[model samples]
Target: MADMPDRTGPVDPPGPLARLLHEALTRLPADRASAGLLLAVSGGPDSLALLLAAAELRAAGRLAQVHVATVDHALRPESAAEAIEVACISNALGLSHTVLKWRRDGPLAGNLPAEARAARYALLAREARRVGAGALLTAHHLDDQTETHLLAKARGAAGAAGAALAAMRPWRDLEPGLVLVRPFLSVRKAALVEAVRGQGIAAVDDPSNRDLRFARARLRAELSCQPDQAQLLQALDDAQAQRACEDAALAERIERLTRVGHLSISPLGEFELGRSEPVDVSILSRAVTAVGGGAYPSPRGALESLVHRVRNESDGTATLGGAQVTWSKTSLHLRREYGRNGPPDLVWPAGASQACFDARFDVEAGAEPIARLVPYGRWGRGPLGHRTLPIGVNEAGAIVAAHPALRWKQGETPPALAVCSRVGWRLCADLAIEARSVLTGRPQNAANRGEPVGKGVADTYIRGQVEAACVARREVARAHFQDG
Candidate 1:
C-alpha cells in the first residue's frame, strides 16, 4: 500500500468553519477591516470551534484582533475550573483571554437561568467596551436555533402561524456601539465538534447541557426521537424568510409614516387605516417606544387595545408604554408622559466627556465639572415651552443653558448638548456613515455628526439649528475654562 498519505503534514487549508466565519464577517454592517471582535466563549465544543476558526482567519490576515472571554456564572462548582481551562486553551492559541465571574451573594429569585443569561450578556458587553471591541460574537449554532424554536412553540409564543419559530438572527444591535453576532446560526453542532477535534482542541462538556431539568435539554431529548428533523428545519427557514420580508415592509412603512422628535408625530389620515390595523399597530407601537425612551415596546395585547382606542376616539389622550398618545381629526401624536415617565436628575461632573439626560439628549461636558442636568419641565414655563422636552444644566441652582435654543448668563457659557428624540439616532448615524463608506467603496472612518437624524425636513432642520447652538455652547465652555 502506498505509504498512507503523510498523515497531517500541514493540516488542511481553512476548514468549513473558517470559510463560513470569513463569509459572515464580510457581511457585518459595520466596518470590521480594522476593528476587533470579542468572542464570548464557554469552553464548549461550539465556542472552541469558533476560536479555532477565528485564529485561522487572523493568521491569514482576513480578520483583525481577536479576544476571548469566558463568563463563569458560578452556579456550578465546576464552572470556575472550566473557565480557567478555557483561558489556558485561549492563551495557548496566542489570544488574549479574560474570565469574568458573576458574583451572587444572595438567594436566587424567579427564573435563575434567565437572570444568569442577562448577567452574562451585561458582563460580556462591559468587557467588550473595555477592550474597545465593536462587536461580541457568540457560539449559538443550528441545534440551539432548533431548541429555541421548539421552546417558543411550547410556550404559546409561536403564534398559530409559527412565526416565533423563525429563531435568532445572524446579527443584532445589543446596544449602541456594541453589536451581537451569531455567525454559526446556520452551522450544525456536529460540524462544530468536528472542527474543534480537527484543531486538536479538547472541549469541556457542561453537565447542564444534558440535565433533563432544563427546558432546552428536555426539548433536545424530544427532538432526538423525531424523524422529520430535515423537514422541520426547512420549514423554519421558510418561516424565517417570510418573517424577514414582512418585517422589512413594516419598517419601510414606519419610516415613511413616523417622525422622530419630542413626540413621534404621525399623520394617520394619510394612510388607509381601515384595512391595515396590523401595520398601523406596528407603527404606533414603535413610535410610542421611541418617544417614551423605553427599553422595550409595549406588550402586544396592550398595544392592540391602544390602537383600537386611537382609531375609535376622535379627540382624546391615552397613555401607552409611558407615552401620551393623542389623536384628532387627521393626525396622531405621541410624547413622553412626564408625570409617569420623566427622567431622573443627572449629575454631570466637570470634565465629563458625555452624559445622557433621559434617552433624548446627548450632553457633552468640557474639562470643568460645573453643571447638573435638570428636566426642562421641572422649571415650569419659560421662553421655551414644555413641549421641547428641554434639558438645562444648572450651576449653583441657576439655569445656564437650555436645549432647543436657550442660553442664560451672558458671560458664563455651559457645556455642549445635542438633542435627539431617541438614543437610537446615534446608531442610525453610524449605519448611515457605514453605508456611505460601503457605497463609495472606500475605507473611511465613520463621521461623528453629534446630531439626531430626524424624521422629516422640518425635524432635520430643527436638529441642525440645535446642533449649531450646541457648537456655540462648546465654544463658550472652552472660552470660560480658558479665562478661569
Candidate 2:
C-alpha cells in the first residue's frame, strides 16, 4: 500500500506509467512483496528503470522489500566493469547490490546470450531458495511483449507464442513460486527511459541488440521504428481475439460432447481434437483448467496428439498435463495419472473449508443418513453434491450408510470419512475441510462395546468382499425367479 506523495510532487497516477504499473502489480501472483527480492538488473534502460522504480517502491514501503543484483554475462571484456558501475549506482540509491558472473562456450557458446541468461536464472533460483525469498522480479515491459507478438505472429498462427506474454513472465511464475512480473510490459520503453532520466539516471546498452544473427533482435529494431503503437497493440489484441475465438469454438464443442469435473474427465478426446468442423481449443483448455485446479498439464501439440491417437487406434491412451486418459465406448476414463511420484507432499489442516482432490467423500450418523462415504470406483470423478450419508461407524473411522445409504440431510453435520488406506498413499493424502457438525462425542455403532472405531482393512476389504458377494447372490436369485 504505497501512498502517493503530496499533489505538489510531479509524480502522479492515472498516467500511462501508473496505469501500466498498477495493472502489472495486481496481475502478480499473490501480490505480496517480500522483505527483499532478487531483481535481475541489466544496465539497460528497461532493467535500469525497473531497479530505480523498485527502489522508489521500497522507499514508499508499499511493494516488497528488495535488493538489486546484475548478472554480467562477460561476453564482452567491458561487461564486468559495466556491471560493477551499475552496482555502484544501485548502492548509492540505498539498495544493496551484487553482480554475478559466469563464463560460457562450445557449440552452445555461440548462443551464449540466451544460454547465459538461463544460467544466471538458475543461479538466482538457487539463491532465492537458499535465502527464502518470495520471488525474483524482472522488468519486461509492453514494447517487449508487442515485439514478441510480432515475431511469433510472423512465425506461425495466433497461438504460435502462447498467451500474450502474461503481464509478467520473463521468469516462470509457476515453479519456485517465483513471480515473474512485467509491470511495465505495457509501458513504453521510451517512457521508461524518461522515468530513468526524470530522476537523472544513467543507462547501459547491449551491443548484441543490434546483431542480425538473432531474429528477435532484428524484429525489435524494425518495431522500434514503428510509430503506430496503437495499430500494433490493436493487432495483437485481434490476434489474441482470433486465437480465443478459434479455441473457444473448439472448446465449446468439446465441452458439449464431454463432461468435466475436478480431477476427472469424461469424453476427454473431444478436448484434444483437431479441427474436424468447428473445433475450439480455448473451451477445451478451460475444461482442463477447471479439473486441474490451476495446474497446467500438456501443451497444445501434446493434447492434439492424444486426441488423434485415441480416435485412430484401438486400446490406446496418452498422458498429458499430468493425467492419463483412456477412451472407452461407454465413457472416457480419466484419472490423476500418478507415477512413482506425484504432487509434492503437502499437509492439509483439518476443518479446511475448501479442498480439492481426486475423489472427496463424507460420512454422518443419523436415522436418515446425511452423507455417504463411498469407494472411489463407485463415483465417476464427482461427488453426489449437496447430499448426506447414514450413521454406522466402522473400524477405520468410516461410517457406514445404515439404511439404503447415499442420501443425507442438512442436519447431519460433524461428518467423518471412510477412506481406502491399505491401497497406500493414493487415497490418504486426499482430505477433509471446514466441515462442521452438531455431534460432540463419537457415537457407538460398534458391533461390540469395546470394539475400536474407525474403518480398517477388515471393513474395507474383507467385509466389503462379503457384501459384494451378497449383492451378487441377490442378482442371481432374481434371475432364477424370473426364469422360473
The estimated TM-scores of all candidates read 0.70, 0.53
Q: Write the per-residue lDDT of candidate 1 for residues 1-484, one digit (tens) a residue.
A: 1111122223346666676666555555433222668899998999988887777766665566679999999888999999998887777667899999887758889887889998898788778766767668888977788888777778786664454567776665564456677767766677678767655667888888889888888888888787467676766666666555555555445444333211222211011122222327666665566556566768888988887877777667787766677776566656566773355777773344555565555555544443677765675543322533545555667665556454445775554455433333421222223232222222222221111111121222221122122223323333332212
* RMSD of each predicted structure: 13.9, 21.9
Over 4 Å off, model 2:
1-23, 29-35, 103-110, 158-174, 240-302, 308-315, 318-484
lDDT of 2 by residue, 373-400 (tens): 2232232322322111122333454443
Q: Give every collision pair in model 1.
A: 349-369, 350-368, 350-369
Error of 1 at 345 (Å): 8.8
Per-residue error for 19 in candidate 1, Å, reads 1.3
Which parts of model 1 have CA positions greater than 4 angstroms off?
1-13, 30-34, 160-162, 255-279, 339-484
lDDT score for residue 182 of model 1: 75
lDDT of 1: 0.60
lDDT of all predictions: 0.60, 0.44
